[model samples]
Target: MAQLIKLEDYVSRYEWNAYRYPSQFIRMKQDNWKKLYHLWRNEAFVGDQQQANMEPAASKWKSLFKFGFRKTAEETAKNSDVTDLPATENELRHYFLDKLYPVQLKWASSTVTEVSFVDQTYYANDRLKYFLKRFPDTFLVMYHPVFNVKKAPVDGEIILISPIGIEILYLIEKQPGTLITADGERTWLVKEEAKSETKILSPLLALKRTEKILKSILKQADIALPISKVVLSPTNHIASLKAPYNTKLVGKHAYEDWFAEKRNLVSPLKNHQLKTAEHLLKNCRTTAIKRPEWESDDNSVFPNDTV
Candidate 1:
């Protein structure tokens, strides 16, 4: 069985696990802030594997463990081993990679390196954080919703399969521009200047690949729910291109309406699954450095590490 990782609520760990970028972690763990914080602080290990201290019946052990904490419930494991949180993000690779990770990594590495990039990235993250604060684990998936993989199309990243929730596909533009998609034509508007189109990765396409991988993973878990993918834009550049394919290219201004209007989609995770996934992603190591703290949670422990 997969080793079950426990973690406390983020709010509890607010002092320790500071969010360098609020967009990623804040988007999902907002509501659980108080409880999560307490959990993180009060975490204790109760098994040989040394997982975090989880609430009674909070985490469900998986089906693939060989021994140790996965085997016995000694109830005296160390705090490091028995957390109320999930596994660190470094553990995602062992699970699998979805399609979105590679593309986002490329974007973060190549395209995203400017004031404008930081601005929009923060904008999207802000929107996510807003929802998280209001809905907590009910609306959003665990942090990252999609985890990144090292290799693309080869060592497929495992989708943390469970039930369905909102899966957002971000299409952050690197420049200021507009898009034209009235007819079958697609073009770009640079600084209000129109130009023939260039081939770039569209959030719409990313959604397709993510959907394919998620479908396979969900099926394996016997989950039949489908996640809706929306194209999120942090700036007006989203208007420059024509989305000829089936895609929802939404601007920041309309983010709330889009997210709020989302009907029929809901998260089915119990308290335990949500906590497990949330803990797992929080520790995801990203080469992407912290941008700046748009708003302060005021409970972060790693203040110097983040803005």
Candidate 2:
């Protein structure tokens, strides 16, 4: 077995904007087995007796309700067994590659042609071809257009970690809104919204939630990292952030520029830390890009601009 780091070393506090970071993490059956076992052994089985009469707060009936809840939870957990870290990691690879493949083709099409319509068509058909060239092994970026991963060497709890910088990146896609940030703080430059979570979901909240998920996964995998997150936006929305913090924000217009800047900021982690991340990413499959739902109608948002 590869000498993995101690689980404790990977468990660090993750905080957003706040001074104190929260110790949120994923728990695994093995890690909590002892505690869970003790809880189960000491706890009563179904129909255990309790204080049936008294004030509502101190009532035996309440105790019975609590027991039911605990039993239900344990039953659900047993039935919905968590995926081993390695399997989850591999599945994530398939998930991402399925999602990202389209973007790669689009980026590639942006080059090597002038006629937008023709270029789009050709690249759309050849996405798999490019995918084959860009990725040789099991590094999934887009999706499952290509297969044979089962034939690849695979094992362990693989986590798809969102870097700590995820909050800074906004999932931009909206009609209009103003974004502001301090000089050095990181934030997404957005003008759009992904239809998933709305209610004006804060990118900060999104990133924090993503961090929590990774932590939970780490706890389950019994592995860890200094993962981060960043918000991403489209270029069309650059005009929307009238007043924004100096944090990192990128969209269509600034993608190239953002990479140029961020490239210098990826400091080297400890040698082992880097390897762990590399292992996770290498096992993943990038996603395939699906045409936006509106693309099917051909109800043309930009009639003048073809494809």
Candidate 3:
């Protein structure tokens, strides 16, 4: 018989709250002995449960509801915290979980990137931090860079600067069903279950407008760089979608692959990367006062051109 593991022995109080439901995690530990017994006797049953546990959240729940109560059994065996057992499971779990859900970290107000010109700061949420951790060298990510446009301020959710080009990313929360976009339209239609439909402002249009504004801002500093716009639905269960030309509509699963490809394609000279980084850092400020253009006297302008 396999030795049974107790929840209290493996999980710390903080890890319990950070990742899994406290009650659910505890219940699983209490029942693991029976689960292990069955696993040994019936390998087929164990395999089936493991498969169900690996499915996506939506399908996982559907399978659970159809065959009630067995889902928890599977989860107890396959939960990430359970599988990656450490010698000091409690301490190791705490360390890893803290990275994902830091204690007392006020993410909304906390600055992720270094402060730039005029005390400009960039904040990060959990999803953005995930990307930052994975590709630290490839991207200089700025979160919510505010720009002044016609006496009003506009905020771009994320600005990614890389050797290949600059990317302005607008994040969208997960929405159910299919999204349909049309060329030249400002909004897209979402069709949900039972043919229910809703219309929302197109993320592509928002990105384009943001790009135009950003281009104008960069022009003032005499920096002209290629810009691309992307709409990222990090948590969305995107079934099907049509996106505009030259715009990227990226889903959560595709993000890593998409970014990896871009990273591979970009090979900037060290000095060139440094120069671009410095220029953007100097010019892109959240609160820098705009300087008026220098107006020279006509005599001064004509001094070189005239006799």
Q: Cα miss at 278, model 3 (Å)? A: 4.1
Could you tell which candidate, 1 or 3, scores higher by lDDT?
3
- Residue 176 lDDT, candidate 2, scale 0-100: 41
**lDDT, model 2, position 215:** 54
lDDT of 1 at 276: 32
Rank ordering of all candidates by lDDT, starting from the highest: 3, 1, 2
lDDT of the structure predicted as candidate 3: 0.43
TM-scores of the candidates in the order shown: 0.37, 0.27, 0.48
Q: Model 2: per-residue lDDT, tens digit, 1-307?
A: 0111111111111101011110111122122333333323333222343533123222322222222111234544653443222124345334333323333333322222110222233333433443233332212122211111345422222122222222223344445443322122234332224433223434554455435544553455556555545445543434333433333445556766654443343332233333334333333323223334433321111121110
Off by over 4 Å in 3: 1-124, 176-184, 234-243, 252-256, 262-307
> Which candidate number would show the highest lDDT if scored against the true structure?
3
Candidate 2 local Cα displacement, residue 257, angstroms: 2.7
